[model samples]
Target chain A: MIEIKELIKNYGEVRAVDRISCQIAQGECVGLLGLNGAGKTTLLRILACLLTPTSGTVTVDGHDVVRQPEQVRRLIGYLPEEPPLYLEMRVADFLAFVAGIRGVPRMDTGGRVQQALQRCQLEHMAGERIETLSYGYRKRVGIAQAIVHNPPLVILDEPIAGLDPAQIVEMRELIRALRGEHTLVLSSHILAEISQTCDRLLVLQRGRLVGSGTEEEIAGSSGREFRLEVLLRGQRALVEQALGQVEDIDERQLEQRGPDELLLRVVSSQDVRAQLAAQLVGAGLQLLELRRQRDQLEEVFLKLTGSKEGAS
Target chain B: MREVGLLARREFVAFFRSAQGYVIAALYLAMVGLDFNLRVLGGGAKFSSEVVSGFFFELSGFTMFFSVFISMGLIARERETGTMPLLSTSPLSDAHIVMGKYLGALLFLLLITAATIYMPMLIMVHGKVSAGHLLAGYLGVLLLGGATLAVGTFGSAVTRSQIVAVFVSLGIGTPLVLFWLLGRYADRPLNDVFSYLAIHNLHFSPFRSGKVHLRDIVYYFSVIGFFLFAATRMLESRRWR
Candidate 1:
């Protein structure tokens, strides 16, 4: 439903979106994963026709975002990080207004508004002024407004950013319920949230596309590295010696969590936990806990983005 | 057109729902009432035409001032509150958004202007006044208010701060309001240019006296068109920004 070709958006001296290209198919819930300043919002705004590209082109549903912005706008709904809400308006009135402005036929506006209210679970609060609602309800109203006209694509920028934990779960379910019915593109800095909700991940860093694929595809393509955590009742030097014996070991670090307990981190090309455990037993070191740690998507993200912080 | 209507309705209704709108309307009515008592009624027995003319004169000034306050937040407040993306991303064109906002403010201004009809009606009871004159006077106030609101809309489009929008509008509006003063010092051609350019003196004076000159009507319409078109262009430029 969307295709971007070498899109570049520069704000004076700062290049907010570099020459990046990606395509999103219809009905795919894609997550834009990046830290702060990743240009995710800028890219999404370009797709929504809210911002014109500095160069290249972005098309939605076969319409150029720059040349046929109105057509492109008709095909997509967008919710920015901060929900665009009129506080004094009732939820239903706001949705009806949105529906009307978004080109929903006048005869269908009431039905569309009701469907949106039901979908976002905002029926009970339809008559309540937006200012009287809680933040979570307000965000739901924002989503309701976006989807009121039943656009083919919905772009949400950090939909769960400021929500409480319970709100986040509800929002996640709400977003999940949108899949298959509409092509969804959401941006987030949270790794787990994006991974859990999206069909594919587009990892960006410093205004560039660092990686794009399923989590496993990204991990495998980036060369899977096995990281292991070992708890051993042995001297730190002895644990290091055991790890040194493993031929696949690329790097090893031993930290003493207790007087006689050592927590070891070993990075290797393959799982050598069994071999390391044998070596530890052969060396007369008591192995308390030895398990192969699965390579986390977080590590892959950090490696691709070259960031030390796990969560952006 | 439907989108414009919907947006306009929302904006118009919003004015009544918010305290700032009431405050602006109340302050405007109070000023008009005070001016009516102090200037029109207080100064001994004046001719009914003069009283109505004086009312329009005071109204024109207040319309200019209050129109700025009413329009300063039209676009700027949307941006400040992060509601601009809703309109910007909608299928509606930039012209539609600008026109809708303009119409909403114009409607509210007209309502406020209409509320002052009692003052003119009072003149009818105490003295004889032509209905045609009253009609012409109200039409003039509407035109002036429309033009001022358009200028203020342009001002709102240029900034994101309501305070800045007010100053920017005043900056653009003050010169036109002061053109009559400039006309006094200039000679011949320059004086004529200043006189013609003056927003109120030559253009609005005729309407104040119950005379509708075609040239004056055209000037007000021209001001309205030029500023509204400017506001539309300002809105469209946001895509690039």
Candidate 2:
């Protein structure tokens, strides 16, 4: 379990991490979402005991970070955005070194190193020097080193950055496997990755917490809204004219599907699909498909951040 | 202490596995060997004790100079390559990390120091020299190497660039070597102070002359302690900033 109260960090004149309070229960997977300079890295560094908080207090497994840092560090495993690796060390040797420095028993060091290698799916490359590995492999080695000591809390900062599609899938599986073994806190600017991997998220904007919740909860809590997907058997001119008459629709995108049928994407202030269907029918146009896009979390995210994008 | 040992072993292994250690070792040995043959062996000498003392004296300067090169990259290189965060976030204390890197550099320095034993042994075979003098002279080199390496470790801790660390270490070490000259130019209280504080002339001269003083041992140990303490403070302050 981790509890952080009023965690604040200031770098010279600029406040990097403002006073923020959060808690992570044991076995929870939490995602910290932020853009550049949103204090995610700073927060992770504080949790990992790499940096001390300016004023607030953080505790992990009942040990205070400031008062009992060794104890806190013993309970936490941290993987920074850039993995700290010695290019000259082999994978197995590096993991064993990390395990030893982290106070693993001498006799059990090999077993722990093996376990971490297996967990990160690097069993084949255990003897290879870190300098020879690819970026994805190095990242796996980084994660293996972090978790080799079997700490209760694991923190990964941008674990999936710069990974290919297949590597990303494998990494997602690897993170999921760590669910019961440790409480995981990961920070990423990729919203889709967080929405898929984490059970909950804490969103930061300019060093302040703008939102925090599950994806559905964040989407629902923002406000009432609906996204409309309309297929009309009419020309683009008639479709645009019909969408203009619909009240409470904020934006619309009309694409001519064929000579007659058109596809219309409507961002509405409320659910007006029934009224739109009736109006399209009354205007002598066949309403082919009129349905609300279910679970528009991306829309909610963009709305929270004040952005708009259409189907391309 | 066990953690420190483990870290030290890792660091030492890194030194050998990469080209940096071998390169430094080869270059230092070449320089020391060339200097020994040209200045001590090729040149005329009066006594065997003077010849051995000359060998130890010459090696001390090289060891001191090379110690900085060995240790300047110990921590700062890790910081530059973004690897210090790994150690910082580990369960080990800052003291463990600093001491481990220090010992790693010192052990490598000692290894290179031991390699020079052949040059002294060659002298012992042909020349008449006492065992105690040889032991005392080697100890002097080790102590001096420890002091210089500690200064380099402190330099590594202060900055993120190994080049900058080399400059900082040399800046601190060169003045101590030149203090003997300053002692010559001054008078009264200041003159005595500078003379006593000179790293080589005051403290190391007795060892080079086949005499071991407890005060010199204490002075070398103090130099190591003072710089290591400063390094630890630099690490702690960096966390706050």
Candidate 3:
């Protein structure tokens, strides 16, 4: 339900967000993938109406962000990188306060707060002061406040940035659960970190929209040729000898995995898994596994950004 | 308007929820008490009316000082701790946020002012003081305190550092309160303007003397309104910046 056209935001001499544009359909879970300084936060802030675009138009539904900010604000729930929490306030009270400010009707504020509490699984800590909670719980509270008003669009900037592995898994589940209820937009520096949680990805590099689509689509758009990996039970010579007959095998690597098992990586012009599997079994070799390379996207992402993996 | 009240109540209650409130209260009461014992009530056999008036006159200075302390964190701390986005992204206008914050700090200032009533009652215990004198003096202190708090809010709005906010507010308010002195040495129309702009002497004196003038009332409110409006504009400017 959001449309942005050629959005640009400048911080004086620094162009934080360049002329970039994208649309977020209703109930679409979109991840803004980028490394540090990729303008993810700046772009999200523009969509959240916390910052006005330097040029071009951004509208939520039919309301322009600059001209009709209050209406735009009413339609959004934004969670900044740092959880906007008042440490002295209790969990439920903080959510209630957020609900009030977010324009939830006073009569329904209690119920709304409780619903948000339950959504974030913070009902048990409802009465606890914010200062007494751990960082993970605080992030949950941040999410709770964002959903308290039940806005149509929920913008979470770096939602999983500071979480431990277990917390990240829980947060992933939490974000996944929110997909059908609202249009979700979150940012992360890693490609695989949020790819599984989002329906589509908007890859940014140095203030530009470099790539946008699903994982396979992004991988395909990256112009990567066909590739596959296979595991087999045989001597290297016999495996290589069997695969030497395949005409489409442009390049291949055969590495010994165990005494009898061998690992084979193949790059080819066409599908050769069926032919390769038959060749292995025909040569009196046991075929253990054959599939597409799983980490191709990671390589594609690194190639696109031209930066080392996990640089940010 | 309803949002203003809700936000104000939240901020007002926040003061007592932490140790900051009690520390400010304790320090303020002690400072005012020490000044009252040594300066207003200790010196000589002054008339009860003069003593109460002098108490208010001295109390106004402390009120302004403490008002700066109270309001320094109103918005600055929010920005420092990353909570400003919650307010900035909300449907509430900047004016509403500023008013909510101003009213909250004002309520706390008034509460602290209320706590100082014991000092006045101490005057009442032995000396004969008119209730009108006491009330009018208190009205002046509250207005002066509130006006300074608005200045502090403006200061807080412009910067993210509370220390800078305190200094900026003091830097702003010190000159306004000292305008009467500037008027004393300056010439012509400038003198009249400077004297009128004086926040304390020219405006607050009447209220301290148990007489409420519409002009002084207008002046205090104008200061409050002008600064609060400036603060709201500062807050709104953030979206563009």
Winning candidate number (TM-score): 3
The two-chain DockQ for each candidate, comma-separated, is 0.74, 0.71, 0.78
- The residue pairs found clashing in candidate 2 are none
Error of 1 at A137 (Å): 1.4
Docking class of 3: medium
- Say which candidate scores most in DockQ: 3
How far off is residue A241 in model 1, in Å? 23
Q: How many backbone clashes does every candidate have?
A: 0, 0, 0
Instruction: Summarize candidate 2's per-residue lDDT along A193-255 as a digit string, tens digits.
Output: 888899999887666666788876777667747788888886566666676678998888888
The stretch of ten residues in a row with the least summed lDDT in candidate 3 chain B is: B117-126
- For the candidates in turn, chain A alone yields TM-scores of 0.79, 0.79, 0.87
Candidate achieving higher DockQ, 1 or 2 = 1
Docking class of 2: medium
TM-score (0 to 1) of chain B for each candidate = 0.98, 0.97, 0.97
TM-score for the first chain of model 2? 0.79
- Give the poorly placed runs of model 1, Cα more than 4 Å off: A226-295, A307-312
- DockQ of structure 2: 0.71
Q: Which ranges of candidate 2 are over 4 A from the true structure? A: A224-299, A305-312
**Interface root mean square deviation per prediction:** 0.6, 0.9, 0.9
- What's the C-alpha lDDT at position A266 in model 2? 83
